[model samples]
Target chain A: MQIPKPYLLFLGDVRDALAVKMARGILTWRPEACVGQLRLDDQTPSLGIDDLPLEAGRERGAQTLVVGTANAGGKLPEHWVDTLEQAIELGYNVASGMHQRLAAIPRLADAAKRQGVKLFDIRHDAPALEVGNGKRRSGRRVLSVGLDCAVGKMFSALALEAELKSRGEKADFRATGQSGILIQGEGIAVDAVVADFISGAAEYISPANDADHWDLVEGQGSLFHPSYAGVSLGLLHGAQPDFLVMCHELGRPHVRHLPHIQLPSYAACVERNLANARTTNPDVVLAGFSINTSNVDEAQARAHLAEIEAEFGVPATDPVRFGVGPLIDHLIERTR
Target chain B: MQIPKPYLLFLGDVRDALAVKMARGILTWRPEACVGQLRLDDQTPSLGIDDLPLEAGRERGAQTLVVGTANAGGKLPEHWVDTLEQAIELGYNVASGMHQRLAAIPRLADAAKRQGVKLFDIRHDAPALEVGNGKRRSGRRVLSVGLDCAVGKMFSALALEAELKSRGEKADFRATGQSGILIQGEGIAVDAVVADFISGAAEYISPANDADHWDLVEGQGSLFHPSYAGVSLGLLHGAQPDFLVMCHELGRPHVRHLPHIQLPSYAACVERNLANARTTNPDVVLAGFSINTSNVDEAQARAHLAEIEAEFGVPATDPVRFGVGPLIDHLIERTR
Candidate 1:
């Protein structure tokens, strides 16, 4: 049997903790497929633009579990026409942040297809773990961390939490940090800034405590939105987790504009997040990044969901944590 | 005749407007000497234990300006350690904004001799031009855009205004932009930020139809102080100007640990006040920076004045704008 290739990826600054967990997970899945992440700071004078071909060069068949990919088709400056062209020549798949509102999709897609890159939409591929499996959550408790409007994380966290709880097991949901600085332009650096996430978690569950299974949520608004990014790192670094459950924006958002919660595009977020965790040795990691919703009450939102599912295989119903349930039960069975 | 090498040179984050003016002035005056400016962004990521050595490699062999070099040296991790060693090995003189502080003198002398990089003290430099240079108040009036406590700009503007007024010439000084928001994290788009600096002279003399130059007198407390490096680039950028001036700090109370302002160094004053003809981009430019007052009284002030004259080879005297005399008459002659 041919060994399946794993991909590595991450988002934003590599220093982010969740990204670190995801990278470690990729390495765990296929140590040989390990690939790191890359990010360029705005302060650096333009590294004079890359001349590399995007898709073709990316598909060089390194068996990459790339932590993430580059955002080749981003807000390219007019003078960087050469750089944009180089991105097309590399044969890397293009994944936009938002589907409908994305102005660069057509151009990027044309470039990707022309180069024969396998562009997968994460939304459509995310069927909940129980969608086909008869067995429900075997027995496990999940610990989740989320920030922002807490809508996407809330839904995702609840689904996993409920699945486990229905099995007569315990699962906990924790929301911390509001990404208030993104819209409000105010900053406060303290544990209390996230409404005492550590303290509250300490009260609910001790770090030294163990369960049949344990999962920690990473990634969301706090990872990238500047003021909150550092706080998120601090939280995760202190937790010293058993496993990392990384949630990503796979396909696109259900809304036209992502507001403050724009997901990373294509290899950009993945590569960076992956690089962040290359050093941290986590045991098991399951990751997902996509948006899907069912029975949409909002028309535009519903349309966005459909578009994302078609484009990135990531919709609300699709579980980003592909084999997460099975993996959780496996751990639970062993621990119990 | 062989051109003489500059006994001193300035290193600084010339990307910062005021710092650039001061650092660049040293080069402009002695263009024959190899003068290289380095930009040490405060936000560069650290590698290993040290930062990536973003500016480490840029250290040149010539007189090192090392403006705000303190930002680089510290207990950085190992990666940064190697980078710093590389810089020192490459023979780049390192210095910091603290050169005007008493503690920096020894470092300055040592770095100068060892690295062949005369770390020039910005505050010690003087505005190259006298207050009055008897040319019609060229182009638009001079509105020295600066931070609120731009005590340097304030003093420069007052001195320039007095010169222009005494010489029967006309000009104005204005403060622009009520606040500095561009410096805020992710609040304003980078491209549109430059629009903030379109007016300053008019803000002073023509702030309102009824406003006079005296009306433009704003206390330093009113200016924005995000990091309080003592110089506010947002203010300079916002008040896009006819001519810009700043007060560079020199060691003494004339300033010892001066108040923090725009850039948050001991040089809370503009290291140099530069006057450019923005209209046609005239080749002739006027530049100025301040000296700290060591004066305990008339005798001491005069004694210090003689010392400055001997050091810089320029006719040194207490500011006539802050006084009244033949010096004031010369200023009027220069500006009018």
Candidate 2:
């Protein structure tokens, strides 16, 4: 898939919890491709790509403004229409992670049409797929299994894929959700897929062309996550991964959205994921861990990583903070 | 919902599997609502409402000819369009159970429109639902938990609901499939729903209004069926039923569509279903069994029912042949 350089736009108050999903995804996964973030919420200090203004981003030749949030219901907030209108009118393409298509909205669509820019609604228009038959896939597969939903499964997979590409290895990152769809031009939002077709979508994305190549399938949800366990199972069954890279947020006590439910220990999470994976593919194995150290400092993150490594007897690293080098290297030496 | 009497039209060969699904469902659940079957296949003798010809059904004041077969993929077959056109020309409303809406087909739609008769696409407009939280339901619920797919879970639920109504009890049969949708006036095709929303759709359909009333919720695939276990889990979690009526097809040794996978024992099926159900509702109980004895003779069917009842210590009956009286009585006595 051809990658597009995009200006990141967080139209809402940047400090708000809903605003950061797409922004963080782009900032973490494809930082180099991101020209800059438009600081709609002026109160907060601009970090990373937010240092450059929209005008500067335009001058730097950013083609699209990747709307920076996979908000609840995927609905564009009414207040942000003006910012979207401005972005479209300025000859910039608009890419949205919302379930509601950006092209469906009148003002933004009209502006984009007049300005000759494309509106990419990443979540919509996913082709309907049939039920997956667990046939033996013909490629080296490494799935980034998560400790919880939004714990950097996509980031870990993409980082590993990037590393593989840098090393002149044939690799592909299969996106599973909206953020991943935005980053990688192709993917089915597995959670959005109907119950009967989850595994099918997974199978569709994680196809094996050559035994020597790798398909780093980005996982969604977690086996321990009560609400999302089905999606987790479907993806796991679909991928039928030979090796698993456990992705986890450093200090997440419980599953997000379900605060009452406590997060399982690293060992328990890995065991559950592996057990589920082994149901469809008996020879499945956990390669390593991709720890999300975004919430912790360098020393704290490193100490926690070491602690998990000692506890689970597996190599762990933050793909962003450090890199998924240990996990990638392990996968190469083992599977490839 | 108002029941409409229509001439049952199965344009295909009578022995065709799809022909019998709607015919059997209607005959078993709402026989009074069925006028007669139009025997397109000449060799086979028509039973029940099939004895009356289309002219006879029309003379008897049948307003609509319910297209009694729910064919897979919901597409109206090319040959069947002629019969549908004839039905429309004869000043009759058309009801189809197919996933492909009857209104979408140009010829049939135009014919119905021009004839000033309504075309009911039963499975077309199921509302989108949220994720099921498995909250404690208020009213009595008796879900027909099947041993496998196409084992007459819907049939048993409808039969029990009819029995309850005959006994002057306020009970509703909630349909989960296309055949059930045609048999009843409404239902969501739960299988078509996204994995995350299956439970939610179940919760939506099985509403708790009065404590005295009962919801005879139709089950989908089996917990033991490998391909459909996720849906089974979601439905079980969604219903949070007070009681379960196990549905099984006698003489079936393996799961449908998956021939290599052997069917689990009765005890294992019940245990797994109850365990999954109890995750959402702790006090849930197995009320009875709805055994589909369609493959066997009367004596053999009776013997098998008796054997299952004696073995499992639960009432067992074929809803179509023996009626669901024993199971209905058991549920009424226990839950009420």
Candidate 3:
């Protein structure tokens, strides 16, 4: 398979004209852009790009696109590859949806390039990175949280409390479901957030760090959600936190599916995270190093500091195991 | 610190008498059960224990319970382990709020064994392995999927399509999301599908056989959600699948945040899976895998798989890289 240099693509039920229109905007901007997230009935819904103006592309030659509709016609289309390719050649700038995964884009592109087939995969139109400006938070501090109501939320908030107190400053710890952490400019409407950002509200703070205290937030699920959309990234961009301390579950076999999809998976998460980071640009990303008990013979928590340090690029100490001091120390060092 | 055998517990909103009653039932049945899901706020909002009368056992020589309460007065009246050693002394029985991970449960247990702590922590609970079958799926042979939408709902449907065809049977593929996948005989809820059977729906006709034959069943979202309040585990014990196929995001690292509240850290995925497995008792477990392509790397994916395999002993593969055929073959071989 010819690997295509990766580009972002957003996946949705393109049969929805609004979704298709949104995708069209991306395609128009980049001749090779691909639209995705089409399910089986997409074609029946009258969203076919058969008549879309692809002629604008001999200039760019229909950016190698992959046209996937969420479903295979009663059977994998006999000329599925050919018909789709021809459509794009004839100026249909949409590829069939391949779920939300753009991981195969690079590979598909490489193959298409070798075969001299212009490929347009949906990975090319993923939402751009998130960056926002709002009430900022920052500091070097230790936080020990009680995992009660909202697990990640409490941890983030409590950690923020400790960090802010250590710095002898205060900043609001807001969990905006996507619109954003907080906006410094005039209040923007949800419509604008989605229309303008093509995502949720921004979760950001002022990059300048004007706030006297650091706000550490956790658990309130954000970032990965599409509706909350670009808001999380936007907020982070604005905050430019010294270190992004994210606490979520990494799938571990031994953990008994402990961290199921209550949230983001590793790939989309990283993609969105990096996308957000490219805009927000935090100094570091520290995943709260937690594991499910049954998943693996967890590295002996006591003897596992070196591994933690090596893997995370920072010292590792369990607060529950080691007194809260060393754990906090490492957390601070990580942000710096 | 005393380490103990951990059991997986799913305690949904303890404030709901139903939830508390489930906890009480677990205590009575398991007796050695510890570590429940912190369903509600331990403070004013929740009764904390749902009138189950936790105090009845206080006479068991100050029964050691390492309880982590949100409103848990930092200074407890008695019988709770805020300190690690105190937890060790509470051998055989312990309770704590949700999302509190044991960074060193096994190791501590081992150490305590040496120090004579004789501890017991139901942090990692396994379903009863024996599969008891009294009923079979009647109706349309709808496969109820319990996999999270996180991996995109393609797994069960995709696998269903592949498995049916491989067995030389033309199966109708229907991924019912908003609407529930229908079936008859023993009513298989999400709980049974996850903990008991290999596949949620009893039998699936491959969708690939005929596109016109497809019926994409929408998920009711919350309806499939296991009601931990009811002693649902017993219900699942009725239907045992031949082989259980579980989908996982192999290298999807972004989900690591949910574990903060001792809520299973995405590992809850597995616990929930097994919760259903306990009832269904599917023999072989086939795990379909994928990753978040946005931010993670191949190394993380490899590690995630290796780690999960080591822990669950289930066969997992990424459908994107390795087609579903090989995974099916592996499952067939394991079952044979």
Candidate 4:
């Protein structure tokens, strides 16, 4: 799904910063694409971007009003319908990452229809996709696989894409989740797709490109994560990556939300991912490690990275704390 | 997803026997649940069952009219709508394994509603399920793992369940696909569920039961299949089988649809399935090998089974030809 931009991010009375993390991510990565922020009330968290009303944002060339903040139960609040309807009437396409679809609300749907605008439900709908054919596509892909959920896979991919662009190399960050879609302005939320089409959607996300071009495919749940490993495996096969960057959090005690399920060792995680990946791309190689070191001191993080690099004989770094330069360097060198 | 019992199989002018393989499966496995067969034309293949009109079938205690034949594109043939509506008017619940939903047809929907009957589109609908918690539950599960799609995973599971029942052991065949669902009269088609709920559906299919009871969970897809490994992996984690039976079709050269992609070795398939399965059930073990030997002579089939048993040190048999007795023997011994 291609979300229209420059976006006016809608933060509907959400007090928690985490609820508007998608807004923050879009502002941080693609600030130029965001025209302004729209809030329901003064209590809402500010994304540090300029605040603009619906008409003003539209006048400023905002093409879409993005519902960027998540609420309790991921539903669109009934009270916020008027603003969404007003935005639709103003000739702006409405987009949402909520569990509820904007089109499902009659007011917003009718308004968008009358105004000849669109409602992009990135989390709930995807373009029709065929099952993955396993044909070798002509592009170099680097995927970030993790030891568990929420372990910097998206961050690592975005960093790698930015680094590749900075070096004047051809690369694009392919998003496979809601927040990533907002940041990239286009993607399929593979997790929200029908189970039969996960891999097919992944294939659509990153299609055949020039042989030298790189598609940094963001991964999802880990192979060992019982709740979502299916999505992860399907994405892995569909990507058919030429290189893999293992993502992990240094101090994660267990798989997310399942305390009884312990995280696998880094070695085990890497080995298992590679083994499954080989079925689609036999030449796939581990390029580097992207460790989330936010919980550790700089010195300790550096020491851990050094130990990992020494043991695995690949570059390792925290993409957020340091940068993805070393990982990109390894990727470029190996691809060359 | 409990389909009402004593069905009248509907053969909608389908000339090919393969198109009605689901009907054949139900007849073979659960003959008691099938009252009669309904054919639109005399040219349609006979299922060796009593042929009856809709009214007569209903009088014979048929609770449901099962559209058991598949068409070219899996759509509900437009010409067959009148008969389906008539079936509904006769107060018979309708069930179909077609890509098109029975409820989506307005005539059938209205008729069913008016007559107080139900429309069951088994292939397109699933009950809501929570994400898999990866917790240990009561009762043992034995899942069939395969090297590729259509390697008889469902048949092996059904045979095992039947064999266990014959010995006066507590067992139930838990279906995961369309044909299996028809035979068992209840199941969630895991592949058709939303991607996030694949494992959840599997967990729902086989719930907690007596400690001595066995839920023979039918499997789908293959770990090495590019199009379907995600479903396989998710089902594996959700089923969390205490014992897995490796299903392989002897002499098969490649994956079912993708000829370029070769099937993995028996050792690789077993190892990968066991490794992934261990994340959910740490104590999971390989019970035996359920090899399909239809392509070979009896002597060759037995010889191949003997060779496999020697190599893997597990019982191996053609569940169709030699029966699942050896595999059940191994499972019983291991569990005891």
Candidate 1, superposed: residue stretches over 4 Å from native: A1-151, A177-206, A211-222, A246-262, A266-271, A278-280, A287-290, A294-336, B1-336
- Give the CA lDDT, 0 to 100, for residue A31 in model 2: 73
For residues A1-336, write the lDDT of model 3, one tens digit per residue.
122322222222344454444334334323333322223343534333333222333333433333323442212243444444444444333333333333244443444455555432222222332412222234421211211112233334444444455655454443322111111001222112221231122332122343334544333223423122222323333334444443332232221222322343433443344433432233435433332122224455444555545655644444233323443455555545
Per-residue alpha-carbon lDDT of candidate 4 for residues B238-326, written as tens digits (9 for 90 to 100): 99999999998988888988998989999999999999999999999999999999999999998999999999999999988999999
Q: What is the CAPRI rating of model 1's predicted complex?
A: incorrect
- DockQ (Cα-based) per candidate? 0.01, 0.35, 0.01, 0.89
Candidate 3, superposed: residue stretches over 4 Å from native: A1-160, A169-213, A220-284, A287-313, A317-336, B1-176, B179-336
Provide i-RMS per model in Å. Answer: 21.1, 2.6, 18.2, 0.6
Estimate every model's Cα lDDT from 0 to 1.
Answer: 0.31, 0.76, 0.33, 0.92
Ranking by TM-score: 4, 2, 3, 1
The docking quality of candidate 2, as DockQ, is: 0.35
Interface RMSD of 2: 2.6
Model 3 CAPRI quality: incorrect
Candidate 2 lDDT at B99 equals 65
Candidate 1 lDDT over B1-336, as tens digits, reads 011232123332323344334334334323444333333444322111222232432432242323322332322233423333344445554433331332244543454466554332222211121111112222433334333333443444445555556655544333222111100000111111111111121222233221122221211211122211111222222222333332332332221122421232322222222211221122322222233343356676667656754654333344432342333343334444
After superposition, the stretches of candidate 4 with alpha carbons farther than 4 Å from their true spots are none
lDDT by residue (B37-132, candidate 2, tens digit) is 776667543554555555676787777777776456657777777877887888878877676778888898899889998887755556767776
Query: Over the stretch A181-266, how does candidate 2's per-residue lDDT look in tens digits?
Result: 77776788888777787778888888867988899899887765546666777788788898899988877776777665567778
Evaluated against the true structure, the overall lDDT of model 3 is 0.33
For each prediction in turn, the share of the native Cα contacts (below 8 Å between chains A and B) that it retains comes to 0.00, 0.31, 0.00, 0.83
* Per-prediction CA RMSD (Å): 27.1, 5.0, 28.3, 0.9
